[model samples]
Target: MSFDKFVKNLSEDQKKELLMVLKESTDTDNKVAPKLVPKIEDGSFTTSIQKKQTEGETFGVPVTEMPRFNKFEDDGSDHKDKQNATPDVELTERRRPPFKKITQTCTRCDNTVETHPQFYREFYICDRCLKK
Candidate 1:
């Protein structure tokens, strides 16, 4: 895309035509420096860190300095520092949250345990599938 490189391959008339074409293609936004495209160079083609320009949460290992994350980010809002964490005694006394409870009346074998809501709300997946 450089003028020096492109003009080397052109005749006088063809150069004029090429220059006109280049001028026509030029726009005001060239200040953004067209994305540095890596061809077959830059070593491996499968690197995940050669990230695309983005405006959102770009996940995975960052190409630059990695921001520190505490334990909260790993388990989300579940885990916390020992000082702020729920005591084991309290957890044992509290009723099990619904998300963990197994229900009955499963479309599969009802006589066993109650329905596991994770499997029942969608379709009946028996204990066999649960093992899977």
Candidate 2:
């Protein structure tokens, strides 16, 4: 309706009553309204939620403690030898093959490398391999 027509039809008391009823309905709307909290997904892969942070904390903190090596620290200073220092003399020993000084004889060439006891059992390797 036009302003003049509406004012003409609505008495002052009727207009006041209508305004009050409208305000009341608007107020009641708040009570019936649903909250808009975010639907926090469980953040889980298989229905298992990973704890991002403790209850009292708002954010997660990373563990930083790890192993560290220091060169200067030493408990046994008397027994410790300097890495850059070298000894006055050295003792050397020669290494030998797995088998040596075989009194055994080769079955093919009759070479005296067989007739040994509790050995690798390298019974024969010459004549047969040469034939092959």
Candidate 3:
């Protein structure tokens, strides 16, 4: 029997009892499952206690001083020849690789045509047939 017909066969008291049982089952399921996240109250969560900081430890080795940030000194002993060297020639024109075309028969028109691999894979139709 259909769900509508089965529900229609139930009396008024039986329908009320079924609804009560469904509501209790859902409430018990929600209470039994563990909460994934903690609930926040008054717009803030509980803060954790901070641990004490220890000094003079670098990769488990005791160092006398910490490294300074953004400080670099140049002694000018390295790259002395490269600074005075000059290039002989330089190209002024931009170069690009040639496009690769594949021959495939058009799905729409049976004529064989050359097209890029990407266009053939996407539409499987030639440019002339696609424009038409």
Q: Tell me the TM-score of each prediction against the true structure.
A: 0.18, 0.24, 0.25
| Lowest lDDT block of 10, candidate 2 | 59-68
Residue-level lDDT of model 2, residues 10-66, one tens digit each, is 989999998899899999997898877665575744554667774444434443453
Residue 25 in model 2: shift from native, Å?
A: 0.6
Ranked by lDDT, the better of candidates 2 and 3 is: 3
In the range 22-79, model 3's lDDT, one tens digit per residue, is 9999999988987677566767667777666556334634444656344478888776
lDDT, candidate 2, at 71: 46
Stretches off by above 4 angstroms in model 3 are 34-132
- Candidate ranking under lDDT, highest first, comes to 3, 2, 1
Pick by lDDT: which candidate is best? 3
| Model 1 lDDT, residue 107, Cα | 55
Which model is ahead, 1 or 3, in terms of TM-score?
3
| Clash pairs, model 2 backbone | 104-113, 104-114, 104-115, 105-114
CA-lDDT, candidates in order: 0.63, 0.64, 0.76
lDDT tens digits, residues 56-99, model 1?
44576674766653444454655566778865673346686657
